[model samples]
Target: MGGGSFIEEVRMLGQGSTSSSWKWWAVIGGLVALPMCLCAFCMVSGLGVALLGTVGLMAGEVRPAREVAEQFLSALRDERWEDAYARCAPSFQGQLGGPEELARRHGGDRRPVEWSFSRWSVEVKNGVRQAHLEGTLTTASGEKYAFSIELRTRAVGSGEAWEIHAFTMD
Candidate 1:
């Protein structure tokens, strides 16, 4: 008689038959086990996380508005003008001229040495998500000043990404 269904063939594969069922079992088992093995390796060796970040699978680790703001400020603190500029929304980018402008403005004595966010408010309006942050920033001269920043979520890949929409410091 003809070979049974695929599942039945797999079930009979270990019965020591000389039939082609072992080939089917090998193919099916490989298909099933390969992904499981890859996932386990990724989880154990941390490669999956690095791959996810490199491939833009999840927009890095700054998904939330607060995180985006903190990252932006951290970049400014480090005088990484391009990194800080990259966090600005497109409209904001227009106002910034470029990363060079960012450096010209925030670099040297104007750079923030440290900062902290004291209050946050988030809301979604007309399909646009926005976060408002208020905090204090310390300058390189050891002067503390009040600052407020607004962030908005924009479409990125299949999800949303936070970007600095506007900011003010005194």
Candidate 2:
């Protein structure tokens, strides 16, 4: 009876079908394409989300100790006093005075003639992640000096993180 009922409906639909068949054709096309369209949508959205995740990981929102140390030096090399100072540890920030102090000392005539990372070391200290790096600094008057930075991880909601703790570069 079920098969017979379906056949009867199809036959009736065929009998009254319009000459142009545009309306029935649209309904039939939609019925055929709905599932395909939904599947494609899911695949595209999934790929888009995967791409975004990869980009986020590369950006290092949850950075490790060594990378943070490198970033700190890069900020100093660019004479971005506020950016470099802001990377300091919460406890260290108090001792470093403030951003204005950083700029006052490092900016203008006192800025390094040039600076670059010389070497790096990473280890766990009493369960805290740490990175030590030496940066080569040169002054405009042809004076060469060795500077160093130490960075350590601190709690952040995204998970493992690092910020500058202390340095001999000042």
Candidate 3:
């Protein structure tokens, strides 16, 4: 064969080898990259879902025990006996029967009273909540009584909505 023809043939073979190598490289790269991309996408989507769930829970379900307790105390302070009694946990209401019964049991006269919290703490266990409130209760007669009350609460439905379940004075 002529020298020029031989060189042309060699050049064509080199080109073909280069093209084949490039194709193989592209295939390997795609194989390695696909799963990595999928994993990254999954991780991002999982994080977004978790954040959304947390926000929904904070907005909907988890009622702070402190707020409920404060409202209950406010009702008592205003001498709204029935209102205050309504705020009590169902178990407590059942035990006391009614507002008049509760007042007699606690030695309260169904009159306005002042109360101050000395210490307070709240805890949640297995989705149930409990609050320990220690404070002084002052009657209209100027008598002050130190008491620690335990309040129990639980989430009622979807979201963080909560309702009092019980109350006990110790």
Number of the top candidate by lDDT? 1
Q: Count the backbone clashes (under 3 Å) in each candidate.
A: 0, 0, 5
Q: Model 2 TM-score? A: 0.54
* lDDT value, residue 80 of candidate 1: 88
Cα lDDT tens digits, model 2, 84-161, are 898999787888788877767656655666777767667777998777778777754556778888888887897867
Encode model 1's per-residue lDDT on 28-138: one tens digit a residue: 899999999998987877976677666573333224888889899999999888899999998999998999998888888878998988877777789998888899999
Question: Which structure is stronger by lDDT: 2 or 3?
Answer: 2
- Arrange candidates, best lDDT first: 1, 2, 3
Q: Give the Å error, residue 55, model 3.
A: 22
Every candidate's lDDT: 0.84, 0.72, 0.65
**TM-score: which is higher, 1 or 2?**
1
Cα error of candidate 1 at position 108, Å: 0.9
Question: What TM-score does candidate 1 reach?
Answer: 0.62
Model 1 alpha-carbon drift over 4 Å, by segment? 1-63
lDDT of 2: 0.72
Off by over 4 Å in 2: 1-64, 140-142
* The candidate that achieves the highest TM-score relative to the unseen native structure: 1
Q: Per-prediction TM-score, please? A: 0.62, 0.54, 0.51
